[model samples]
Structure formats: C-alpha cells, structure tokens
Target: MSAAPQMNAQHINAITNAAVIIVKEHLGMQTGFSKPYVSGSQFMSSDISVVMGVNGTLEGQIICTMKNQTALSIVGSMMGGMKVETLDEMGWSAIQEFGNWVAGRAASELAKAEAAIDISPPVINEGRSTFRVEKTFLTIPLTSEAGEVLLHVSITPRVNE
Candidate 1:
C-alpha cells in the first residue's frame, strides 16, 4: 500500500474554510470550526453519514454526519417545509444531494488555492457502518435551529505533488 498524501498548511486552511463557507451558505446557519486532530481510524460514528471520495490535487474522503432529527429538519427546510419525520428513501436522497453540493462548492473554492479536486457521488450510511479515517482529519461543527452536524474532512496533497 502507498503512503497517504501530505497536506500543507495552505491546503488545510483552504479546505477547512471552504467547508465552513459552503455549509453556512447552504444551511443559512452559524458554524463552528474545530482544531484538526488525528485519530486511529473511526473518526466518527454517526446516525447517518453522507460520504464522498475526492481525487486529483487532493485525495481522501469527505463525510457529513448528523442525527435523524437533524437530517429531517435540514432537508425539510431545504425542500420548503416538506415534513421529514424519518429518514426514508427520499430523505436519504436529499441528504446525498446536499453532500454532493457542498463538496462541489468546496472544490470550487479550492481552485482559488490552485488545488483542483474531483468529488465522487455521495454514499449514504444509515446508522450502520464503521468508516476508518486512516489519517489525520478535520472536524467542523455546524449548529442550526434543527441541531448540530459534523463535517469530517480528510484530504491530502496527491502523491505526485
């Protein structure tokens, strides 16, 4: 197996900032930034997680985790008052789309830092799955009227870099 990519200070700052900006703009809420930390895998165990793999200048995964109520409330508000008591298929889809949108925005913002990234489709994990980070990650807490959600972002400069 190959070693993980190294993330410079600039890359880290850009990625973290992009994540916070995208989430706050999309959800229209206040977000809190957390200091980046290293964990021996299992960075998070959440009720639901929307994960997407990224490639290009940066490589790693971006995960969005939240509780059932948080998901419902956010999706409900996004869809214009659509009731969301539980996470049905439609709810899952909504969350997936939101993750993709956020990642896309982050990628766009990364461009300003000369970092080109490509995000894959989001994979939904509903209360069952153990995702290993296998590298240092940054977690940012976003609070809204609904509840608190965490963004687990792990990206490193590509090997060629």
Candidate 2:
C-alpha cells in the first residue's frame, strides 16, 4: 500500500471488501458483491455520498456512495423484506445505518495494516463524483437476491491542514 494519497489496489480492496462483508454478515445477506470500481462520476445525483475524515500523516476522507435502488434493496433486506419499491424515511434511516457499518469496518481494516486512520461517523452528503490523480477510490457493486448496490469510496488529502 502506497499509503493514503497514493493507495495501491491491495489496500483499496481490503477496505472495500471489509464494507461488503459487514453488509452481508450483519444484514444476513447472501450474494455476490462485485469487485471495486474506481472511476469518475459524471454527476452525483441519485446516490448517497458520505464523507468520513481521517486525521494522520496522509489525511483525507473516505467518501462512500450508493444509488437509491441499491439503498432501498439493502434497507428492505435489513428490515426483513426485499421488494422495496419506495425509499421512505425509514429507508434513509437504514441507509445511514449501513453507512455507519461500512465506516467502522473500513477504519478497522486500515488500523490493522498499521495505518492510524480515524473515521468520523457517517454524514449524508451531496456532490460530484470526481477526485484528484494521486487520489484513490474504491467502487464496489454489491449483489444479492434483493438487488445490487454500487458502493463508492474516495480518498483525498486534507486541504484544510
């Protein structure tokens, strides 16, 4: 792993899989979640992008995003159903919970690799799906009987510092 700003594919996979495992193990889901996809987004609508700050030598935030359909399916399975037609308030609440789980898993995985990164609690966010070159991100497609979810992870250095 080339550290934060220049993360290698290994490190990225570690974090992405951790989140996927959390969703499956915790939510009792059984399916195949696709490998992580690292790409730029033309727009950021129709998805939830959450940023979590990490304070350290290479500081940045992990931005996790997912589409409405994915969120609804995951949330519905979490609530003992899979045919989620509409994403109601309860869906948002559940999505937040999922985000929380993902953040915790990512942070823990990083820590195990001797990367002292602290992730703040998940927060709802909206923005474009783009990042700098030295920047690194992970996009995972979660597959399940319920449906598939695209989880995006972006890493950038702290500019405020």
Candidate 3:
C-alpha cells in the first residue's frame, strides 16, 4: 500500500483551531476538535454532510458531516430558537451556509501561514455516501452538545516562492 501523506503540524493545528473558533463564534456553541489524522475518505456515520472544495495554495475538499437530528438542532439554533425537524430545502441551505462559513474561516486562518487558500460553495448531501481520494486526507472530528461534526479535509500544497 502507498504511504499516507505527511501533513505539516502547524497547518493541521491551524485548521483545527479555526474550526473550534468558528463553531463557537458563529453557532454560539462550544466545540471540541480531535487531533487530525491522515486517512481515506471513508463513509461517515452521519446522515447529512456538507462538502466544499479547497482551491488555490492547496487543492482538495472539505466535508462537514453530522447526523440528521444534529443538523436540525444546529439549524434551529441558527434560526434563533426556531424548531427544525427535517432535512428539507431550508435545512439543506442552512447547512450549506454553515459549511461555507466554517470553511471560509478555516481558509483564512490557514492563509496566516502565507498559504493563500479559497473555499468553494458548499454542496449538501443526505444519507450515507462514499468518497474516493488518491491522497491521504486530514480528518478533524468535532464534537458539540448538539452532536458530532466531522471535518474531512484533503489538500495538496502548492509550490509558492
């Protein structure tokens, strides 16, 4: 088997830290980020996942996965106490926006290392799905009172000098 890619500790740390900060600031919820690790894009346990692309200094994708119920709870909170029970069009839109917000913030934080990165608009998907990637990915698992949010980050650094 081919060896997994080696990620810069600083880069991974920046992404993880940015996720924690954005979730708290944007959602008003405390979140915990697990140490990032390199792995294939395995199917997530969650029913809903928001996927976004990373381009520019790094090229890859970012996926924000969460359970359906958890997605509802988060959307509800974002709506300021409104109840959300289903993954309808509105729910999907909210999730995509949330994913965008997180990814944008993360890319900005990553750019602090002088690596210019930009995130693509989010695509929301429901149920279980499989992802295939040749390069190993940096996966960050985030936990909150609502539920778990898995951040599947895959990137290839560009040569900038």
Winning model by TM-score: 3
What would the TM-score be for candidate 1 when compared with the true structure?
A: 0.84
Candidate 3's residue-wise lDDT over 1-161, tens digit each?
55444556676677777878877887889988676666565644368888888878777777888888889988988888688877677877888888888888878888887768888888888888776766666777899877888888777675454
lDDT of each: 0.76, 0.63, 0.77
Angstrom error of the Cα, residue 75, model 3: value is 0.5
By lDDT: ranked, best first = 3, 1, 2
- Higher lDDT: candidate 1 or 3? 3
Q: How many clashing pairs does model 1 include?
A: 0
The weakest ten consecutive residues by lDDT in model 1 span 32-41
For candidate 3, the lDDT comes to 0.77
TM-score-sorted candidate list, best first? 3, 1, 2
| Model 1: residue 67 alpha-carbon error in angstroms | 1.3
Ten-residue stretch with the least lDDT total in model 2? 38-47
lDDT, candidate 2, 66-161, per-residue tens: 666666677777888767887677876777777777767876776666666667777765443544434444566767654565565555434443
Q: What TM value does model 3 have?
A: 0.87
Error of 1 at 4 (Å): 5.3
The candidate that achieves the highest lDDT relative to the unseen native structure: 3
Judge candidate 3 at residue 76 and give its lDDT.
Answer: 87
